[model samples]
Target: METDMTKGKPMEIIIRFAIPMFIGNLFQQFYNVVDTIIVGRFVGKEALAAVGSSFAIMTFVTSILIGLSMGASALFSQFFGAKQYEELKKAISTSFIFIFIVSLVLTTITSLFMHQIIHGFQMPMETREYAADYLRFIFAGLIFTGVYNAFSFLLRAVGDSKSPLYFLILSAIINIVLDLVFTVMLNMEVTGVALATFIAQGISAVSCAVYTIKRMNFIKFKRKVILFDKKMFKTVASYSILTAVQQSASSFGMMMVQGLVNTFGATVMAAFATASKIDSFANIPMQDFGNAFSTYVAQNKGAGNIERIREGMRGVSKIIVAFSLGISILVFIFAPQLILIFVKKEAVDVIAVSVYYLRIVCVTYTLLGFLQMFYGFYRGLGEVNVSIILTFVSQVTRVLLAYGLAMTPLGFAGICLAIPIGWFLSDALGVIMYKKIMVEDSV
Candidate 1:
């Protein structure tokens, strides 16, 4: 049951697979960063701040979808390697059904409670209004995002990461143009930015769905084949719930950090918000590599090729470290220039502060890369509870440290410091767990 991926040199395999994922992820980031740039430049600082404030809340909603898709990927990749085509198709159909129902219900509930949810964080009124508006529109698009993510994950699981990347690239271009049309030409402000994102996501989702259905004969199902299977649903839910909790907890921690940023005034809040978006763009390569490893590990693990999994991981680790160091150095050298790309001259000081925060986090990107890769490895191996526990520990520690330090002489630096420190701690824990549990078991 050796797949084409596992038949290649490890480095060549990882890079070839990861390149498309990296490109697709970068395009996904482009969708968000483009919106941020357009809104920050044209819509005013407050509007930018508003959009930034919704970051955590939006992540909170999307996390469930991401987790479900990730779980499906894990199962599909493993079954794919095992040549269980029928099971893989069943998993895909069941996952699609699960994602649509859960995403719709979650979106409805979250939208209805949006006000209460935002207010619970105790953010400033100005920031809250903007956050609410941005969130309302983004939530409306969850169904599209969830479905697209499920399909994309399925594609990647079966060695088709490039298709999703192509679709995302096309959608991103369309999104950028729409951003100009809606925000710059029409002066629609935050609403326009939100609409642009929604429309782009919808397009990407549709394109991926159509492409997959048309090309992948496995996905074509009869009415009898599509019938619900409780066992499959339970397996998907079990993995997804833990992954979702881990993500939701991390998002909750970010929301707390956002609350702290809000208290500091709109200028600082906007600066932090914008910086986070920039940071997301910077981290995509490592994140994509992590995703590639997850699929690689899942498939190889199913094929009983643990040695190749280790080889793949080792190759990816080197790549991630080198890329992290290179990116960090470049970002440090061009911090101010990069900041100016998204913000105004008047907001230079705020942007500078954000850049400083990014540079600080950049110092630890290698460690963070390890953490991400190991988490992916765990998920691919169906060792999800360990991943969940590690995430909870990291988020809880981050919230406490950020809150306590912010109250001290450190202020926002305390808030910024929380990120790297949490990553270091989480990475250390992941390394220990991997060695003690996974490595030991494999040996």
Candidate 2:
């Protein structure tokens, strides 16, 4: 069921559209959360640290997929909303073909450098092998990640968020079953988690791709549509490159932060890793809302419904603030309990560190929520270059602050502060940029 967001009550449509996405993202995070929990409880803190340490590198690859997905979503929303079905099919085809090529290149390169990259992260000596083994399998399955993401993004782009949600629900189940079998029954540890994720994602990708193309008349592929269209290629590449740069840069900064955390020893690293999983879960709704808003804005922009876009933005802002407040209070209360989910027996120091980190970061969720929404809106309007600059600024501030604060008496506290500080700065700047872009467009 394709939705014309440009025609409905902005709040109603936005909420309905976002709910499936929010649910899907929650299931999506289950992949990581499950991996961390099993690895921590069954394998040990060292194994947990290895998985945690791989976050930055995994994020680096994951960001490219995100960037490409954003590109497809933005463009497809525009085309579908404008009723340009022919061109829309071409765009969809072009995206799949282009992503396939990029995936092959990235998989080969990353697979070759798997060990070196782990070492480059300055992964602690004790957990280096665990990290390398996990990352190698993940890198080898980059195509699965890329394919699933492309299908998922394209589905959301055309207002079929439900399909993707169904696929993710199934994938989550597959991953969990595999995680238990490999990690518990067979003792594969980190490698088991990686393999489980890869296989599950691959199944979802292929299944969803077949179903979507066969079912959606607008998305059906013809030989002509699948062939490279230079114009379509340029359009998508323009959106993809800047978004990719923005995401990769942010991930690299995180990698730097992880490297710094690695120096603090495995206890702190475990704390950081566990804290991050909790953090991702808390922010899931916000991220999904941001994406939903982006698609909404893109569709309305194509339909020339500027007023609808404004209403959608204001609507999502309220959603962000309300959800953020509720999540912050919950996380503040349950920080310790949440940490225990990852480890069977909590190390006192790791629990204390993780709780403190969560307390500092949770309250600032609203700021991060607003920042993502603004980025989504800007990208939807095809002002991706501006979004790129804003993202770069935010990531740089985070890295610099992470380094500076880690050195100060604030120490790890400073490292914690860097997150909210980055969020505050990014949100502040994003609002300003949004206003500027709107003003110019209105004229």
- lDDT of each structure? 0.81, 0.85
Pick the lDDT winner: 2
Those runs of model 1 whose alpha carbons end farther than 4 Å from true positions after fitting are 1-3, 218-220
lDDT of 1 at 334: 81
Q: How do the residues 246-309 of candidate 2 rate in per-residue lDDT, one tens digit apiece?
A: 7787788888888999999999999999999898888788888888888898998889988778
**Candidate 2, TM-score vs. the true structure?**
0.97
Clashes of 1: 0
The TM-score leader among the candidates is 2
Error of 2 at 9 (Å): 1.1
Model 2 accuracy (lDDT, Cα):
0.85
* lDDT of each residue in 1-443, candidate 1, tens digit only: 11356677977887888898888888888766887799889988887877877776787778888888887788888888888888877787787888889889988998899899888866677767767767778888999889899888888888888888889999899899999999999988888888888999999999999887777775456667876678788887776667777667777788878877888888887788888886787788888888888888888887888888888878988998989888888877887788888898788678767887887777777776877787787888788888887787778888889889999998988888888788888888887887876578873
